[model samples]
Target: MSIFSGLQPPEAFAEAALALGPAPLVACHNDADGLSAGAILVKTLQRLGTEPSTRIVGKGENAYSDAFLDELRGRAMTGLVVTDLGVSSRLPDLGLPTVLIDHHVPTGVPTHACVVSGIEDDPIPTSSLLAYRCAKAIGVETGDLLWLAAIGLIGDMADEDGFPEMEEARALGITALRKAVSLVNAPRRTASGDASAALGLLLKADGAKAVLSGAHAETAALLQAKEEVKAALDAARKIGPKVSAEVALIPFSSPCQIHPLVAQAWRTRIRDRIVIAANFGYREGWVHFAARTGEDRDLIAFLAEHRPPGAGEEYGNGHRLASGGALRLADWNHFVHAIGFGPELEAAA
Candidate 1:
């Protein structure tokens, strides 16, 4: 009757875990997907009589940077598990036994270790699903984590296609999480700094009821923030239709705090098959880019190839059409040019 009852882990993953001794190091994404994956890993390790040191990193942050590599060296970590992130070519350089369990489009598979992902060839899977399989491989059979895993799936927009099994597992629980996600995703103005507070509430909430009740304060705050998001969206719309033929650009100078919501608003107005909305962030030197693909195109693939150096895919749970990234303010013009938009479009927006 457990959600994971019929699930089986890969043979290679079991072999790798067996080869490595106790006390593994887990590097996971900071978002819902990564958090759920990390939680599953923790439970699995505990069941296996092993301990794991957990570290959370933002998706947009450089996972392979020298600082991260140096941290790994300092830990003297022998076994590494990366979840909910795309595999980079630099992964092998860390000089540790590694296992990759992710759901992103891979740049390339690692030659030095076991890699598991959900690329085009494989049936679509979430990082939490991969983590659950890994847990099963190690003989851990807890089903309590399904709700958490479902949160990642919904947060990443994976629910669009509708995973019947996951949906059945989530049942009424997902409704509360969706409300929580919406409240947390509200826009920001000034430096009220409610975004982090919202995320904290979602992360710590005990259950569906707790999550909903905990978000009340944030929801109130979001009611006020919604105005700013609307204003930015309105501004973007004023600029979009005129610039459609010349260049597709949605520009707003507002210090919008909720990047995703603002982008979604702009996208709603765009009738084009492909629309990209650019917005000014709280920081003066940066801009956020949200690209929404028409039904005809795959925005996930497009954003993956076009993302800036520091950018990472938002995953939109599974709404491949909705994706976002950030770019330096200085590179804004160059990015627009690279995307094939012209100066006239810039002028119009």
Candidate 2:
């Protein structure tokens, strides 16, 4: 029999999740969607058999990063399940059965791994919903977990995708789910970029109400994170953008991950140009930026044309219209120059 009972990539992925046995390490991204997905798998794994260990890939770290893979080495894991992290052939060979569950456009899919991608879906399913399907295929009663997937849908702004489950969840309480998502997203946006508290709340909370009830200590942490991020965002929003004919570059330095929000804030206002929000202070020795365009331009191809030498997988790796990346100071300077910006925004070497 096939490991996933002869199903295809995605359906097989759900089945593989159920079969990946003894002890698998579930590595997930550190955003609201990622954490919710991880939480679902963690819950499902617990109900199935032995509990699975989980690693939340946070700021400046990816599942295949050397530091991350080093942490996985020598662990007594029998399998690996990765969610929400972007797919790439750079996936390290850890000599174990692996499954990748994601919605990001794949640059390359590892041949040895089972990839469940909803990237081509008209309305892409978030990793949380994908993990929920895994839970169902495991034959566990997942009525409670449906709301968990709803939390991710709202977090990723897919609440309007019109999935029946989303409507059912909305009837449960959209306001609460929205609030919980913001809270969950806040911790990882802060300078510390630690999402442990957010993950902790998701892992144990019975539902959205439990997440926001102020009943758990982690809830307080999330609230504080929200306040910190809001202040940072307000400060970033105050700065004006340097507009060119075709692109608007809004450059600000902050410890918060506010570049995406800043770019989003400008995409509507500028309407005629691609809005690039660059945050040079989010991490040391790197410039992180997000690109948003009002038009239907293919940003990934646009970025590839002006690609910087130092740009890695972090560059132009998201959806075609909505993508961004990190570049070293030198490469960022090269990028700004290549895009027709003068020396004013270039970093001092």
**Candidate 2 per-residue C-alpha lDDT over 136-250 given as tens digits, one digit per residue, 9 for 90 to 100:** 7768778889888998898888889977778888877888898899899998899899999999999889999999999999999999999999999999999999977678999
lDDT of 1 by residue, 1-349 (tens): 4221212235457777755458788777655566667767766766777777777665235465666777778885668888876665567455667887877655545676577665542347678767766766666675665665666666666766566547665665667767654544453232343344444444455544565573446545555655666665565455543254423456655565445545565566655655666656445566665666545667766655554454433222234666656666545555566566666434222
Error of 1 at 172 (Å): 5.4
- Best-performing candidate as measured by TM-score: 2
- How well does candidate 2 match the true structure, expressed as C-alpha RMSD? 3.1
In Å, residue 88's CA in model 2 sits off its true spot by 0.6
Q: Give me the candidate number with maximum lDDT.
A: 2
TM-score of each: 0.72, 0.95
Q: Estimate the TM-score for candidate 2.
A: 0.95
